[model samples]
Target: MNKNQPTRPDGTRDFSPEVMAKRNYILQTIRAVYQRYGFLPLETPAMENLDVLTGKYGDEGDQLIFKILNSGDFLKDLPADAVTSMGSKKMASKIAGKALRYDLTVPFARYVVMNRGTLTFPFKRYQIQPVWRGDRPQKGRYREFYQCDADVVGTDSLLCEAEIILMINEVLGKLGVQNFQVKINHRQILNGIAEAIGAMDKFSDICVGIDKLDKIGLDKVMQELADRGVSGESIAQLKPILAFEGNLQEKLTYLTTLFENSPNGQKGLADMRAITQMLNSFAQAKDFPTDLHIDFDLTLARGLSYYTGAIFEVKVEGVQVGSISGGGRYDDLTGAFGVPDLPGVGFSFGIDRLYDALEELNLFPAEATVATQILMIGFDEASFAYCLPYLYELRQAGFATELYPTVEKKIKKPMSYANNRGIPFAVLAGSDEMQVGEFSVKNMLSGEQQRVKAGELKTFFATK
Candidate 1:
């Protein structure tokens, strides 16, 4: 690595102001929706005790954690033979005690447990922060990304699940995402499917394989299931359930019959039915927009070990990107932290993926990319000085305004600068306008000019 060379880590990125503006747009939309639903904002540290995150997310997730090496000669006290013989995995545990958080849910659970004595029951909180993972970076995945999560803890009500679904619909709808579906499923349903097929003990193996169905296709998923030692007979029985397709009610009806012999499956089906009914009733009562679609997807095994009940995933209709958001119900997430019996349900919007989708669809508002709404151009030192107050006032009036730094810069230079930066309006405060207390405002987009009194500049730009 050359000292003179500038670079970002391979899996990380630098968000330029324009990109940040768009990112903020998505985050603000999510935050507003979360707040509207009575969820309070909360934040947790970026790093946690390695023990805290280790066993939470299944085996694959554990491998992706970015562990931090212990500071101050971590190996000083280790036995030389132990270091030589112990595998890297075992050695890492001895040397590293802290790791960057992989997701918000675990940390939130930790927070609730630590604060359980002071906080009220059914705590509704939202967290907008970056999480780290050491996974290979690609188009939609990153080592560092933001997860906008809203969770309601300390309650096991089905209404919490329903409310989360509605929140997902509201956030995406408000963001102008035209084509997307909320795919709902259940862990118990997945377990029931496994049991129905006689793969009761291979539940995780079955889910790990089936969860890849969308990415690797049916044949590959079935092959993976076989490779995992699932019997051919079991695979045959599982195929149709994975292949089942219909409206929410139709799918539920079919699943009801399929899981009839499996108690877990029946319970999952019943839960799914109740949630869908409640959602439908809520939609009908409120006359919800038609753009939001909710479907029961039996194959939506979210792959996380913590999801004890309903699981949700949001996917764009016409794009090939991965799920833009996902989450589920965790019945005892707080139990690991000594606060057992506190159930919670929530979802996290992948800000990066959502931004990519919005950008691909050109859904961002026009103003999102504009850095400055108006630029103040000064012809001379006196004119520049004169324009300072007006510039301050424009900004004070809530317009993104800036004054050209140097008075000696030519008119064409400032105009071109404004044009290149996508600044919509430029205020010319040369000697003529400076003396009369009026300014010439040029519309950079249309090349039209208008004269406005200095005091009325804010109103003029506001209207424009």
Candidate 2:
């Protein structure tokens, strides 16, 4: 490693101003939708106690958690034999007591438990923040990424699920994501399938394989099940359920019949039916734009162990990228912390993946990249000093304005700076314009120039 040469760690990145502008655009758009739905803003620390995060995301997610070593002689208390003989995983547990948060949901659950006395029930909150995962980085996958989450806790009403779906539709529409579908499922349905196959002990094992269905197809999923010691008989019984096909109603009817022997399955089917019916009713009542679509994907088993009912995953149309957003209902997520029976349902927009999908589809608006609206150029020291007041005035008038730093800088440099920064208009005030009390405004886009008195500068730009 060349110490002098700057480099970010692997699976991480630095966002330049342009990139940050686009990111902010995405964040603000989602934030607007979240606020419109009555979700107040929330924030939690980047790190949480290891226990709070460990069992929530299932085995794979636990392995991805970036553990933070206990500070100040982490290994001080370990026995010499243990320190010398333990493997990396065992050693890590001995030395690490905290970890970078894996996701917002767990931390939110912890927060609710700690602050339950102050907060009202059914608290709705939106959190936009980065999470760390020690996973291999690839396309649409990152070790560090922001999850835009909105969750409503303490309510079991399917209306919460319906409203979340509507918010998802409105948010994607506003972001110009034209093609996408919200795939809905229930955890109870998966449980019912496990019970039906008499593999209740292998529920997690089965879900682990089934969750990969979309990524690795049916054949591979079957082979994986076999490798995991799932009997051929169970696979045979489970295969048709995985391959079940039909419209939402038809699929539900089929599942109702298939899971008829399993009460969990029947309950899950009824829950799914209720939520979809609520969604249909909402669609009928509101004039929703025609861009959004919802589908009942029986195969969608969000791998997280906490999700209990009404799970959701969003896939962009015509894009091979993975789901852009996903979440589900969690009952008693706070129960482990002694705050039992609090039900919450929410979804997270995988901001990075969403950005990549939007970029691939050319969905970002052109204005999202423009940083400065006006750049003021000064030909000489005296003229540059003269332009400062106008720069201040323009900013006061609610325009994104900038002044050339030094009058000693050449005119070409200032023009180039403005051009490079995508400033749409340039205010050119030199000795002549300073004396005349007028400024020449150059339209960066059209190459049109016009003279305007100082008093009319704001009005001129305002009209444009």
Candidate 3:
């Protein structure tokens, strides 16, 4: 490859047709599940006001937002000192007023706040769109990728949370992800832990450090807390909580006593219990995955600061990748936009990582990548013209049919095209076949050829 050749920017990708087909398979599965749960489709602008995105994603996330430079003379309005001496942060605010959205949830909150009066209460909406993050590119992480999100606003019902869990099971199962754990935690639980450890003032630091417990070990996390100004005494107190382990009931019992004096912790425990109880009832009465383990992980603190209630992160076993999906309840996300009292809970499916996992596991079905059922090839112009009506008829009969472009004198060219594209069937139309009032249909896989009349093409492919 020449160095001078123009290339795609780092951290982004150009998806070929084959990759897109499999991606669409994942998207369709998620969309169907969302619709089954009664979520209407929604879309928001790709760019949001810089202020709307800046303070929402925490300090680390704010750094990853891709800002758009102001058009025209952006610096013309700034003072000479402001233009030359201001730090990057201050200059950024003055120079860039818009940025690509970091995630769908914040923009959804902005949308709900703007359209509150015209919308129904408890609005259930699903948004599947690309997001941009200016982080270093790595396997399963991208600067530009799509998120499939489903959310319910205007209600604080724990049922929404329960339903979200059920949907998680359904969506992953449908996508053929066999071994995955839906790790659940709550913000108040972390708060209670902070209070128990006397690190109340350092709750955010604690959550951020704890979120890395899986990647970095507990000792490092404790050291990080200390480095972040957490008390040595508090670190000692939190060690036991970090090492605590048990079944769901056992963990709940332990936390109940630990948080007995903490009302926020108690509230979190109540919500967790209620949501699990609902899930259990469904398992007993309906078609639920009996083996689905709701792992109550204390260290699963999603780094997003907006999550005010339950937080969730799903890890796929047997795959060396990050969480494939995550989300949580936000009691006042819309409130940030001046619409208070609209509590909501939701989750997002990270399609890019999910695709990687599925591809690695070889779970995508063969039919998922089949773009065309048949390709019609002709050896001459008249023969190609003859395939036009047949192409129309096959498509009308609900078959994905396509006429091979160009007029090739030899069968080698068209046959190579069909074989390379994995097109299952090919209809060969020549003067002889047209004269006989029939077409030569060949199965590209088996090399089985059969002469079928024009009227019988539909039935012929249908039976195959």
Q: How many residue pairs clash in each candidate?
A: 0, 0, 0
- TM-score quality measure for candidate 1: 0.92
Error of 1 at 365 (Å): 1.8
Residues 52-151, candidate 2, lDDT per residue (tens digit)? 8887776888899999989999878888888568977788787898999998988999999999999997899999999999999987677888899999
Ranking of models by lDDT: 3, 1, 2
Model 2 regions lying over 4 Å from their true place? 1-3, 55-63, 69-82, 85-96, 289-292
Q: Model 1, residue 128: what's the lDDT?
A: 95
lDDT by residue (tens digit), candidate 1, 1-464: 78799778879999999899999989888999899999999999999999999988878889999999999999987789876699888888989999999999899988888888899988999999999999999877889988899899888889988988888888888888878889889999998888889999899998888888888999999999999999999999999888887887787788788788999999898888788777778877656766457777888898747889999999988766789999999888788777778888888898888888888888999877767888999899898899999989999999989998987555888888898888889999888897788999998878899889999998887887
What's model 2's lDDT at 157? 89
**Candidate 1: how many backbone clashes?**
0
TM-score of each: 0.92, 0.92, 0.94
Q: Say which prediction, candidate 2 or candidate 3, comes out ahead on TM-score.
A: 3
Show where candidate 1 strays beyond 4 Å: 1-3, 70-82, 85-95, 290-292
Please report, in order, the local distance difference test score of every candidate based on alpha carbons.
0.88, 0.87, 0.90
Evaluated against the true structure, the overall lDDT of model 1 is 0.88
User: Which residues of candidate 3, in runs, are more than 4 Å off?
Assistant: 1-4, 73-82, 85-95
Error of 1 at 319 (Å): 0.7
Writing each residue's lDDT as its tens digit, candidate 3 over 256-338 gives: 99998899899999999999888878778765577774799999998847889999888899987789889999888677778
